[model samples]
Target: MAKAFASQGDLEEKKTSFTEIGRGLWAFTAEGDPNSGVIIGDDSVMVIEAQATPRLARKVIDEIRKVTDKPITHLVLTHYHAVRVLGASAYGAGQVIMSDKARAMVAERGKEDWESEFARFPRLFQGHESIPGLTWPTTTFSDRMTVYLGKRKVELMHLGRAHTAGDIVAWVPDEGVMFTGDIVEYRSACYCGDGHFADWGRTLDRIAAFAPQSIAPGRGDALVGPDMVAAAIESTRDFVDSTYRPVERVVARGGSLREAWEAVRAACDPKFADYAIYEHCLPFNVARAYDEAQGIDTPRIWTAQRDREMWDALQG
Candidate 1:
């Protein structure tokens, strides 16, 4: 059977420049679109956060080709989301790296997430059929690990749960630049289908501690300078807090999902209404928040059918 496109709205798939941050570090970002980072070491290249598909990732590869022909030695998946990791095969890297937790998510709920995300944002999956299947990491780590591309050192750390249980960030200490997958978004909505609200806030705090001069967030424009980076983190924290707190408050007052959704909308709509993907993310955000507020630790699976059912129930 042919798969259906996910989003009903229009999206532009524009090409963007690869901005150089340090001696060998670059950020590839489309205007308000998913962001990917590149680190060129003495010997090889490491790409952080592959795009939605091989066709889309080729655009990034094209940019990388401009600088060097160094083999893409590593493709680091910051998390297990289909939009992020499915492009791994396109890189043809010898090692696909990820957190053990992230690999587990792929093993556990990858198929459901693939279906759910494809249904929600079709444009992101531009060449969906080209995807080999769910991306599985060849190398997995628990806490932290360091990889050297000749002399440059890239540190991968699994911070506390935020966007997902196994969310990881790539820190280039020498460059003072960080690649935070979906843990921090500039002007984009933080998708919370599998997020931990409370832990998410704390995770932001941990990211802030790095004091990155520049940040290439999971989506949206890259943040430059300390002020912009701080603002991005705070804005992301505010979005998560604004979405989760109101829902939690309503749940405390014995509110139904509809009531909780209303409360969340009332609190978040005014401030975050203009953010990218806010409309698409709100229903799932509220559902996850509601479940957490009711003491559900792990998030439930979101199938395409369940996505629409929840959206209709809460968004109505």
Candidate 2:
């Protein structure tokens, strides 16, 4: 392949910012890179997504230190993806929480995913060696779990499947503030390499039902007002639709993978060419869409070797 994995050329560091979307809810966004959120309550704090490495995670800690002295009592993983969950050891929180399905994913594919992702996006995992190992949750719940940072009520729920089978969204009901992991990226390309297309659209509906006032998506700037929130969700839906529909149409006509890939570029590039990671996500996204549209229910595991093989076949 001419280009590096996904983001190899994306070497310039983004300027990270900590913005307060609600009274005590914060979003740590870095241009269109992966984001992390913070929820502060009367006595303690909860971090929504851990960075790719402990060293990268500490930057979030530094920002946390600037605003509150409260100990980070809880760590939450929105999914089992390495970039989102591998830095759990950095917080030293009392407990780490995730959906039970996410825990199972870790048990089954954690090592492979770790290797696959590290090679795909080297920029995100700057402090690669600082990672202790695959992040293991100290606590796991099924559908919903309600925890309080003193009086503040934060609800964690698995709202169906979008980004991954085990994706979860953190909701602060009191403020209508939401932390949607990779499920609702704004402007940035959604990495649907392991996603459920139709089910993902349904899951987004579940989020829209909440009518959140402010949202901190997995990437891009945090959406603040209700109007902004609505637009973000719509755009996400559009991205999903545009990518899948073309590929599905090609599949329906019994087209080849390369044919579907060409149709995808003609359809998506016009709309998403400027989106972050567009080049990197295109091959994987097309492959998965082709499979799902052809009746493959589960996304195939992406091992490091498989990554190279697929990239070579498509981009070579």
| Each prediction's whole-model lDDT (CA) | 0.88, 0.92
lDDT of 2 by residue, 1-316 (tens): 2877667778899999899999989999999888999999999999999988998899899999999999999999999999998888999999899999999999989999999999887888888888988999999999999999999999999999888999999999989999999999888998989898989899999999999999999999999999999999999998988999999999999999999889989998888999988888888899999999999988899899988888887776
Which segments of candidate 2 are over 4 A away from where they belong? Answer: none
Write the residue-wise lDDT of candidate 1 on 93-169 in tens digits: 99899999999999999999899888777788878899988999899999999999888999999989999999999
Highest TM-score: give the candidate number: 2
Candidate 1's C-alpha runs over 4 A off are 1-6
Per-prediction TM-score: 0.96, 0.98
Model 2 residue 27 CA deviation (Å) reads 0.1
Model 2 residue-pair collision total? 0
Name the best candidate (by lDDT): 2
